[model samples]
Target chain A: MSGKSLDNRRVQKFHWMSRFLSGWAIFRQSFLGKIGLTLLALFALMALCSFIPPLVDPMYQPMAGVDPEISTVTGPSTRHWLGTDFMGRDLLSQLLAGARVAFMVGVSAAFMSVFLGTAIGMIAGYMGKFADTLLMRLADIIMVMPALVVLLMLAALFGQLSIWFIVFFIALFRWPGVSRVIRAQTLSLKHRPFIEAARVAGASHLRIIFRHITPNVLPLSFLYMTFQVTSAIIIEAALAFLGFGDPRTISWGMMLQWVWKTGHMFNAPYWLLPPGICISLITLSFYMLGRAMDEVLDPRLRKEGQTD
Target chain B: MGNGKQTILELDRIVKRYRTKGFFFGAHGQDVIALNEVFIKILRGEIFGLVGESGSGKTTAGRLIVRLEQPDQGKIYLDGRDITGLKGKASKDYSRRVQMIFQDPYQSLNPLLSVFDTISEPLIIHKIGNAEAREDSVWQAMKSVGLSPPHDFAHRYPHQLSGGQRQRVAIAHAMVLKPEFVVADEPTSMLDASMSAQIFNILLEMRRRLKVTFLFITHSLAAARYLCDRIAVMYKGNLMEIGPAEEVLRNPKHPYTQALMDALPKFVHSGGVKRYETLLQAEREVSGYVGCPFFVRCKVARAPKCSREKPPLKKLDDSHSVACFYAEPGIKTRSGGKA
Candidate 1:
């Protein structure tokens, strides 16, 4: 009996492994997926390396530490790999720290929104009639307001915004889009026979929503999360570049703000271009990742003969 | 076997209608009657078959019994208790005694859940036992459904199993709770001949072992003849005939029931087969809900009589009744039809 049970466990593990491997195989076939994965890996390495520079020399810190010798913006040299900023902060260390911030802001904001959106969408869909109309109308109202513009208004009202507050605001504004997608998925899923079977088996409304509907809608929610991450990163970058960012953090947008404020936008390409390029590249990689995942989740997008 | 027996479930004048969602304004779509004043009484420990064509409301009757949908009018009684408007805990308690096996095995089982999880769900919901006891119950249920060596099939998902295997798993799910009444809605409609026979045997075994009453809804008269103790023929949301399976097949009274028997496939080489010749080749055009539901295609239907007023079910003999104005009971013994 124990041997048979062990075999059952092995079969389950094998099935999961094979499913993951097949998904990976499909993910590898897309050029965008390959490029995005590589670029994201490079940024992850940069985020990891951000801690190394400050440890090597205190002056190499992206924020408070400043070079004693170099007081003004300068071109790249043997000493300063990417030169110094107007405040004499190391641009290389700042760009690396910017990668860390971009990942932090993007993933966390996306995760929070996706979680909130999935829960709300399932509730609205499964409990139709009044709750459906009210929640969906609320989503419609939130979806129409421009996230960046609203965040700007709030930033202006508050004077200065914290990093966590920015992430939270981004999550709040972005959830409507995810909620709409998740709600549509949930609507279709709630009518399936399996859901009716659960109801007939004496499962409560709460049990049906959490135990049955949640697992089915979770894949779609995950696919939407990747897309949400791209928007979150872009929104955060736009806010930071507009000078509404937190004062303490050394993000890519904050780096670009410093370069533009110090009148070094045209002269110092080394100081200005790194943060601008980093912001664009990170967002592009995340967008590519989302597109690739969309193909994985929706089998209709896959080629005919490629099915396992 | 059902003579003078206890009544387990009953449907009294159940009416269900559905309306399509109209435009945002005040426009309303016409109501489609799914079940029209349908009445049925099921005997305890008997497999009562409800046979009909598509859109004939046979499935609706089964769904009503399981409380998946409430009747628009009238009431449903389970064991002499009116259970039409049960709510919350009452509804849950009702579900403990009544369960359902849905049509389409592929669509019935949740793909995310394993066979063990699916079968044990009711046990967990009813708080039947501890983890070990639930496991034991699931094993017993699976074994009764012919899924032997329980651990081998327990962890498998619906996608991994064949249609027959999936349906057996579905049966295990319904039987694990040991419900007294089960509504099996076209359980074998999606399977092949051999697989369907296997499912039929499993259902019979369940009834014999557990003494569970069943409402077996199907479109196949042949299958009903093979499995049901009593059968009811429905047409366009109306019950046409109700009788013992052998008596109905051997001596059909209603023209619609005769038409259903005539439509069954027979061997070309068979000699001297009696034909009912009761069905009109093309359907007669009729407007509105009036008269007999089968009047449109019934060849025996008389103008101004069958087209003007509906015929209520009249008792023919002991435990046999049919709904027809001109039905001749025990006169036409159907020849060359095998049970």
Candidate 2:
């Protein structure tokens, strides 16, 4: 209210802004963070660019006929920048479309699983009698079961799995693991004085969970989500390579599956290499980002920030 | 009756018991009678200190008043209106009117929240002011609590502040709400001597400025002597003595009060002992007992019926009362309650 206090307020405003910006500034300074951000931006660009569509037929729709005279095999021509498949399908188009599919599967799977798991965990942790017993026991059962085997069995039972089906089942199985982790975290957080403080502040049960408890658990969510992006992408790739991916979708794993089935893997190295490299680079980027973020969120991991 | 003090808060015979897990995997462990038939009236603009040893239920009494834990029985009246069984908005409004400064500022505050956010959150929750007004309010609160310049301390986390500073922040949080009634539970036990004095001074200043009625809970009699207008000594969930602070300290009546006075480390001619008592007698489990909860260790319990029957809180004079049967030793008659 006073002139001096007003001046201090303005100074505080600037300080608060800087503290907000510091998270990004600190993250950008890290070596792994730079690479991770660059890789993410690059793939995101690829995924976005695929939507615009190029002038030429990058993927040879009818497989270009097996005859050598027609359009059987071609190296990197002006039309197909990456090259052509043994069946003469354009490798560049496959790569572009594959980026879109991987992005969709990865983001959707991670988002859904994390959202569902956080909800389950918050409820189970905060409201701990029957809800905890029921939800946690269910999580335990799902966690104990072999995830890949279950995914495969479900894929086979459905017969030619759809994109949504894969996303649904992958998220369903994945959430149990996240729920258990978050439940353990929420159990501890619910007892903290801050939670009781919120209760005293007139917060409803929903508000306490969503506002008070959830924000405290947000760092874990971000950390889990980053690793989950990698896991979801890998799981999608694994499903596709095992011939369980949606037949209509042309993912990186489907490209590899084609290369393996055709027996010309060594003879035509270009077809085999691009998808494998993209998968590794994307997953590696996510892993690096996750690790970098771990250091940022939990300052104890950073050497300079370490203090009692 | 002629003290002209208006009662701001009153508890009418409240009882609370917590059932802990029994040892050896039994279905029932030792149940703790946190408070039993505890009654006290806090007057307006006065510091009423609830002094007791550990496990004496002083904290629980404070907590009951704050409605952090509800009493299993009895009524709580604020401003002579029974605010018992308040739910939803009523409960929140009660919180707004009556705030608590918890014992440990370290664990009481949320680590992720800045000091500004911590103090301003109550304002935001209550929807008291807009952003700019809140900034000003927060600045004023910080200044009042002696974390002056406000800007330096406002943006800092709990870890960055010292123990004394953290307690100041906690005090600011309650002060921002402008609650008329504040229950400060050992607000300075964690701080050093000078720091504790500084905190006590801030509390004293707040009381003078705002006419805030405080129920100060502490085990240290020194703190009671320093700040409280009135004092109540508790033992094993029962109130032993209640009176004007100076009168009770000078001319104590209850056996428990005398024991506490004797136990004071010879520094009583001054304001208080240099340190808090290191050896509080190990509390005996007093649940399911009929007599005085203090009977197990009462050095002056002369009556043959001391262990067999409970004594009533009887008045000896205008401003003093004790729960001892032999307060007037010449009269050997049982007053009111049956064994």
User: Model 1, A144-250: lDDT tens per residue?
Assistant: 99999999999999988999999999999888888888888889988898888888989998888888889889988998888888899889988998999988897
lDDT of 2 by residue, A1-308 (tens): 45644665575677557655777776777789899989999999988776544433423432332324335556776666667776667777778778889889988988888888888987898899999999999998987887778889988787888987788777887888778778889999887766766666556788677767887887788678888878889888988988888889889988888888777678777888889999999999988998878777778777685422
Q: List the pairs of residues colliding in candidate 1.
A: none
Q: Model 2, stretches more than 4 Å misplaced? A: A1-83, A92-100, A145-147, A264-270, A277-281, A299-308, B1-3, B22-26, B129-140, B150-160, B266-290, B302-304, B326-339
For candidate 2, write residues B1-339 as lDDT tens digits.
236988999999989889898767568977788888988888899999999999999998888887778898889999988877898888889889898888888887888677888898888888887777888899989999999888788778788899999999999998898889999999998889999999999999999998899999999988899999999999989998899888777767776776687687774455553222222265544555578766766645543566678889988877678888777633422322222
Give model 2 RMSD, 1 decimal: 5.3
If you superpose only chain B onto the true chain B, what TM-score does each candidate give?
0.95, 0.89
- How many steric clashes does model 2 contain? 1
TM-score of 1: 0.96
Provide per-model DockQ scores.
0.63, 0.33
Top model by DockQ, which number?
Answer: 1
Please give the lDDT score at residue B19 for candidate 2. 89
Best by lDDT: 1
